[model samples]
Target: MLKSLITAIRTLTLFSVPGRDTESFSNTLFWFPVVGLFLGLLQALFGYGAHLSGWNELAAALVVLGGVVLTRGMHLDGLADLCDGFWGGRTKESILRIMKDPNVGSFGAIALSMHLLLKWIAVLKLVELGAFTFIAAGVLLARLTQVVLASALPYARREGGTAQAFVTGAGWMHISVASLFTLLFLFPLLHQDLHALLALLAASIAAGGMTGLLSYKKIEGVTGDVLGAASELTEVFVWISGALYLLLSGNG
Candidate 1:
């Protein structure tokens, strides 16, 4: 279990591992939320420190940068690929080919820029509102979406790629375990506020479902890039939802 946890962390972040353990890596799906909690803790600490230092804006920017750095920009790259493929490719073959390419096109560049900008703005708003809890929760929810995508969707590629092992190995049982972990983390944060909890749940489901549907329509299945895109889109959705909730409730 410890090895699986380590594999989850190493695979999801820029963290180094002593050695590659394929078996452990295969079991890492169940621990995805744990890795997310670790990330959330880091961001929460940074946000709290920023609050104390009277540099919330700077801290928020750093938190956003930290996410990119920690994840090695893999999610962002996936988002770019998805954008390029979905819009640029008219056929499944073309879409797969486009997504597999390492080069970023104009559409991809625009999408990445917009995504980063929106994320920065959302984080800035969260910091200003002192909603560190939401930041942490957003990370957890975003990662949970990835686990769902892996377990629920068939891999689009026939020639198995980087994410194939995970998708193939993760079953409904794994999804159940990951969902349990997510609820364990989320319940306490939201138990006192049913409205907030419901809103967050709705937002997460909507984001994940929408992304999955789009991926399915475009390619008939999900890819590693789709999972990456889903993670990023879900994070942004959570942040946006939380920020809007705060604003509407007169807290912002």
Candidate 2:
């Protein structure tokens, strides 16, 4: 179990969990959400400490940023590539062509900017609301969407790419492991606010639904870009949903 957990995180994130590097385990499909949970755990520990220490919003934000930086900006790169491809290309073939290119286009730049700005603002708001747990929960929800995409969709292209392994078939057990780990990581916060917890789960489902539909229509399947987009989109939705929950419930 310990080794498999590390394998899941190793395959999913930029982190290289050290151990035996046999091809069979190394090539195993990465569980996206499980990686997110590991990342979230780091963010939660650091962010909570920052929040408790009376750190400003910017400092807290930097803690979250640091977690991504340590992961080598893997998801962010995917988000940029996805934006470059999905918006720049006029047709299906063109989109795939643009995605295949290594260069980052104008559409990608704009999309990335918007995504970062929104994320920054949302994180700041969460800090203001004292919703540290929600921040962690948001990370979990976003990553779970990645697992759903990996399990449900086909590879968008004929040739191999980043999202190929999981989409091809990572199996139900892999999915369950990812999902269960996410829940365990998140369970600590559930004792604080049940409604917020449920809201995060709901937001996750919605994010998954949105991603699933978009992938079906736009690419006819999932790709690295699709998975990345799902991560970012789900993150955003979780933040929004959690914020709204706090507002409506008079908890904030």
Residue pairs clashing in model 2 are none
lDDT of 2 by residue, 1-252 (tens): 456556667655667777753334422434455567667667766766777777657646775586567557667777777778877777777888888788888987887788777777777677778777777778777777777777777788877786675566555665676678677767786555667778888888887788788767877887877877778778877887877888788988
- Candidate 1 structure quality by residue, lDDT tens digits, 1-252: 777887888889998978555573447889999899888778777777877888877878887888888899999999999999999999999999999999998889999999889988898898888888888888899899999998898999888788888888677988899999998898776546666777777888998999999999999888889999998998888888988988897867
lDDT of 2: 0.72
The runs of at least 3 residues in candidate 1 whose Cα sits more than 4 Å from the true structure, single-residue gaps closed, are 19-26
RMSD of each: 1.6, 2.7
* Clash count per candidate: 0, 0
lDDT of 1: 0.86
lDDT of each model, Cα atoms only? 0.86, 0.72
* lDDT score, candidate 2, position 185: 66
